[model samples]
Target: MLKRLVSAWVWISTGLIALIWLPWMGLVWLFTARDPGRYSVGRWFRLAAVTVTRLNPFWKFRTTGVQIHDPRRPYVAVANHESLADIFLLSHLPWEMKWMSKDTIFRIPVMGWMMRMAGDVMVIRGDAGSRMRALEEARDRLRKRVSVMIMPEGTRSGGGELLKFHDGAFRLAIETGSPVLPIALAGTRHAIAKGSWLVGRARAIARVLPPVETAGMTLDDVPALREKVRTMIAEARTVLQRELAAAGA
Candidate 1:
């Protein structure tokens, strides 16, 4: 009960901060429209996330297994999705990357506007043509030197374990001839589990594995690469869950 109470207060306080900062963020974006790279809106996002996680002190993060990069090549980062906190955590990735998210989220007032100004791609999931359009948009973004990130699971899993993988992310990487960067995010499930409003102070680990080369790979490679990523994430999830369970508070 006390944990839940503290979590509620934290969420409320964060919401209040967003109410204030989001508008100012929008204004900043407008003034710097031509200089998106000059000012990183991601800094503001990371600050907010770090503040919330640090508020409880117990909430911590650990990352590992990130592959060496060329820094010149564009990649489609594919990962398993498990919670809303995934967004903030993923933003903490080393590179300054853009996201591909649902179209509906881009409709939110200041938040959505900021995302648009940041060169993020919004996709309508159901409409056939919309998916293709989203891919094209992502390719264009990559051509402009932006790495595109997508959650291949599409939606959060019921538990810490991964769900089915969607071929879309893989297909996008293949179509664009960009590398497929596979990441396994553990600990987020315990921090803020799926289908729940409650939050916890558990330390989360986001492990970035090696990137799979997609260049010169045909459509036939998608299925095998997808399975490899899925297995990697599943193993990471199991290891994380066991560690967390053993360290009972």
Candidate 2:
């Protein structure tokens, strides 16, 4: 009962923070219209969520090995999606990247407004036209030297595990000749379970692994590239789960 009450407060706190932070971001949008990357403004938006993570006593999140010397050097950043909390975990990353999320997320009132203001890309699942358009938009972000973040799994797993990979992210990387940046996320599955509103206690970590350059890769290489990155993320996720478990113990 106590945990649930704290979780309730955490969610409420997140909502309140969003309400308070968004107005300032709206004002920022006016001046940053030409800067679609909106990197600085987006940073402020994510910091609001970071504030929630700090308020929640039952959740702990951190990042490791993310040293982007040139923040403008674009790469296709991919991660294994464990839960909704994965977004919060990645928010801990230092540099700003335009997130590729579902269109449903872009329809939310204030939250969706932030997504648009941040120049994030959104797609409808199973809609061919939407997928193509979203891909083109993501390519544009990369061309502008803004990294794009995507979850190849497309949906959250029940635990800190991966699903069958999709070709979109890898294909984009190869098409644009951008390197593939894999980030391994663990323990977030405990933060928020599938199809539930209640938050759970968790210690999550997002580990940025080395980048795999796709200088000469083509569409035929997407399959191999996709599995290679998936394997890399899976292995790192295994290590992170152990570290999180040991710390909790």
- Provide the lDDT at 46 for model 1: 44
Error of 1 at 205 (Å): 0.4
lDDT of 2 at 89: 88
Report the error of model 1 at residue 203, Å: 2.0
List the global CA lDDT of all models: 0.73, 0.89
Residue-wise C-alpha lDDT for candidate 1, range 186-233, written one tens digit per residue: 667667766677887666667787788887888899899789878877
Question: lDDT by residue for model 2 over 1-249, one digit each (tens)?
Answer: 987898789878988888998889988887777776777788787787788899988888889975889988999999999999988889988888889999889998889988888888999999999999999999999988899999999997664457999999999999999999999988888888899988998889999999999998889998999999999999999999889878872
Q: Which 10-residue window in model 2 sums to the lowest lDDT?
A: 153-162
Task: Report the Cα lDDT for candidate 2.
Answer: 0.89
RMSD of 2: 1.2
Q: Model 2: residues >4 Å from true position, as ranges?
A: none
Best model number under TM-score? 2
Taking all chains together, each candidate's TM-score versus the true structure is 0.83, 0.96
The reply for model 1, stretches above 4 Å from the true place, is 27-39, 56-58, 67-72, 243-249
**Could you give me the TM-score of model 1 versus the true structure?**
0.83
